[model samples]
Target: MKSVLLALCIVSVSFPALAINRYNVQAMSCASVQQAVKRDGAAILRWQSARNPSLPLYDRYVRNGLYCDPNEYAKRAYVPSQNRANCLVYKCADISDNLLFDD
Candidate 1:
């Protein structure tokens, strides 16, 4: 039982604290929203849709391409914040989208 407990403790300590943060962009200033993503490396920014106020929109924004998957690349995106209609940020997009298809 002691050995199992020791193993569990070691496993817990081996990993860094990588909690994905979520925020309501509408409640935060554009700079605040950007800072959150930069600080966390990645964060889910949520806001209500403009066309449909009842609809919610959210996506994981990243600080840079390093946070994206191998097959994905960072693309410019925007989210609504307290001070701006479109606050610039980056989000992962499928790399295939950039490839040219020859007929």
Candidate 2:
């Protein structure tokens, strides 16, 4: 019993208490912001989308790169004039907007 308890304690402490996958890509240029979104957005969406539908994952979008709005990524519109739209509209959208792949 003591060994089991010790093992459990060790396992718990070995990892972060709150292991959050954060992509703090903020106040960046158009290209940099696009890159960050393209890179991390898909992973974020996958992890978020896999979870229970009741527990939704709230993500933001950088419209004009001045602020980070608490907007659900899926609910955003396609703006042609959008500077960073290439990333959201093309790369991430390629996976999200289309029936590209399941995995």
Candidate 3:
């Protein structure tokens, strides 16, 4: 019974960690991107520059859509230490998507 209780406690502790909400930001610009990062704790910046006159600028991009692909932005932009990832998908946001985990 004691062993079972210990196992249950361990499972309960780890369950929250596994349930973190991982979001992929799609087409975020430079400014609002910062705001999203600050608010959500973590975000993926999907960059899409406008070629035509009808399209919106960088500012509008952040406000309208979500970006995905941190590695792409980190290569060009200045991502902080916590955001920089050695792997393909860089952790661009200093905060974690997981509400439980404090930035």
Candidate 4:
């Protein structure tokens, strides 16, 4: 039992915890938000709703498709930033297999 517990501790300590970076879009310039995603590969961006100021909106943005899961693809998305209302960013989009080919 002691050996098992020691092995468990060693295994747990061997793997480091990974976390995604987050930023408030409203506090950053459009360029800054883009740069953050590019530098970090992915980030969680947050902003307030235009229609409902009290409501908060956020999503995970990626630098490219490499950051997305195999079933998801990177797509263009816009978010409000300090300098631009439609700051360009990439979001992971779901890939639907329902589309039929004409062939």
Question: lDDT: which candidate is best?
Answer: 1
Worst 10 residues of 2 by lDDT: 41-50
Ranking by TM-score: 1, 4, 3, 2
- In model 2, what lDDT does residue 28 have? 38
The sequence of per-residue lDDT tens digits that candidate 4 reaches over residues 18-85 is 46798999999999999999999999999999999999999999999899889987888999999998
| Every model's TM-score | 0.77, 0.24, 0.30, 0.77
Kindly report which residue stretches of model 2 are placed more than 4 angstroms away from their true locations once superposed. Answer: 1-26, 42-73, 77-103
Q: How far does residue 39 in candidate 4 sit from its true spot (Å)?
A: 0.5
Model 3, 1-103: lDDT tens per residue?
9999999999999985464333322333334445665465444443323355353322111111133344322222332222332112224332334345332
Better of 3 and 4 by lDDT: 4
The residue pairs found clashing in candidate 1 are none
Candidate 4 regions off by >4 Å?
1-18, 97-103
* Residue-wise C-alpha lDDT for candidate 2, range 1-80, written one tens digit per residue: 99999999999987643442344232334465455545544322211222463544434433332232233223332222
Better of 1 and 3 by TM-score: 1
* Model 1 residue 48 lDDT score: 96
- Number of colliding residue pairs in each model: 0, 0, 9, 0
